[model samples]
Target: MKLGLKIKTAREEKGLTQNDLVKISGVSRASLQLYEADKGNITLDNLEKIANALDYEVVHFLSSNVVPQSKKTCPPICPSIEKNMSPNMSLNNICEFIENDSPLPPTQSNNSVRIPVYDEVYASAGQGFINDEHITQHIELDKGFLRSYFGLTSFLDLSIITARGDSMLPAVPENCQIIVQKGTPREGQICVTRIDDELYVKRLQKRPKYKLISDNKSYDDIELEGENYEILGIVVGLFQKIP
Candidate 1:
């Protein structure tokens, strides 16, 4: 059965309604409905939340038997674990596997890719100070997830940078790390832009005139009519510690 069906079956067996699941799982009602209907690409974090809410082992949800229908070939978050998962593995085993950040097994290491995390700062809601680019670390991510989710042939164009300020507000919160895919910005997409000496993370707008928009209304939209600016890249993903 599909992962969604498995979740739905487990929820039903628990004698809880969708609303109950929402309250217990802390997952939005809309997302729960989407997962049940198999219309969404549920993230690993959200999947873990749902599994915990139902008091079920997360491996049970991630097993090959319950593969998500959206991406059949794409392995779940950690290929190191998913590739070796067994029906008998407990949740504690999964945790232990994660705490030890060893390289993927020799056979699967080739399937992993490293994306750099830069120490440069960019303002999501305010003016960003320009600094020399320095790579702080490298994070390993599944090659398939990058290709399938971001539609990128290679991981060289991707970099992670820290976002600061509240101008972007709830969308890109202060201190959050943003994954930027180096490329041209599309209209209405959140992008990293450099104007003169300052850097910014804002939504790109090109309809009436070239502008950078902030989600927070208190921050004024930047008109780029005659500014010396360059579109660094678009914000493709965000990484933050789960509260």
Candidate 2:
């Protein structure tokens, strides 16, 4: 469920009205309504207050899939993630427990993270691909390698998607796997962006006005001076088949 729906469900289950929650949690009624409706960007502080008021942990609303216990008993990586012997924690839980915490046990077999692969979603190099939620599989990457090579702070910030077409040509060839990270996009950074529900992989440039620049000049640049756009992520790495 979405964050707003989760909050609304929790509130209804607790039999607390909006006014009651506002009084108890000290969150404004308008803010609470917006949160329950899933409309605005909710802050961590607000979420915590509402969670505490609803008599639940923040994790309860963060992930639908709870951490499952491993059949084999293994040493705990950290105190926060001891509920499961193996790394069976949900994506949200893993991020919650691991971000800025001590590194996990240095066993080669265990020192890895799983990044979701959008098999059906392509960030087009020539044209735009319609964005979707169809995740076909996950790619496992070495945690230390990501941290050292890409300077990644959280595993949750990564995603793997396919790059289609030769518009990005020399730098990002067609049919290559792109490793993108969630961050503030800067000028001239190659990023995945969405406009009118279409996804595109292009380098951002500000030539007095913002635009999406294609490496292959044969393709036309997308002007974003007045068009609404969303920066999905910045391209950090790529994996191409050696054929």
Best prediction by lDDT = 1
For candidate 2, write residues 1-243 as lDDT tens digits: 467887887788779899999999988899999988878767656877887787654544543332312212222222221111111111111112222233233332445666654433433452222233544333346565566656776766677665666778888876566778877678898898766445677999977788998888888888997776777788887655432
For candidate 2, give the lDDT of residue 147. 68
- Give the range of the ten consecutive residues with the poorest summed lDDT in model 2: 84-93
**TM-scores for the candidates:** 0.52, 0.49
* CA-lDDT, candidates in order: 0.62, 0.61
RMSD of each: 12.6, 18.2
Candidate 1 stretches greater than 4 Å from native: 1-42, 47-110, 120-133, 147-154
User: Over the full model, what C-alpha lDDT does candidate 2 score relative to the true structure?
Assistant: 0.61
* Range of the 10 consecutive residues with the lowest summed lDDT in candidate 1: 83-92
Q: Candidate 2: deviation at residue 11, Å?
A: 57
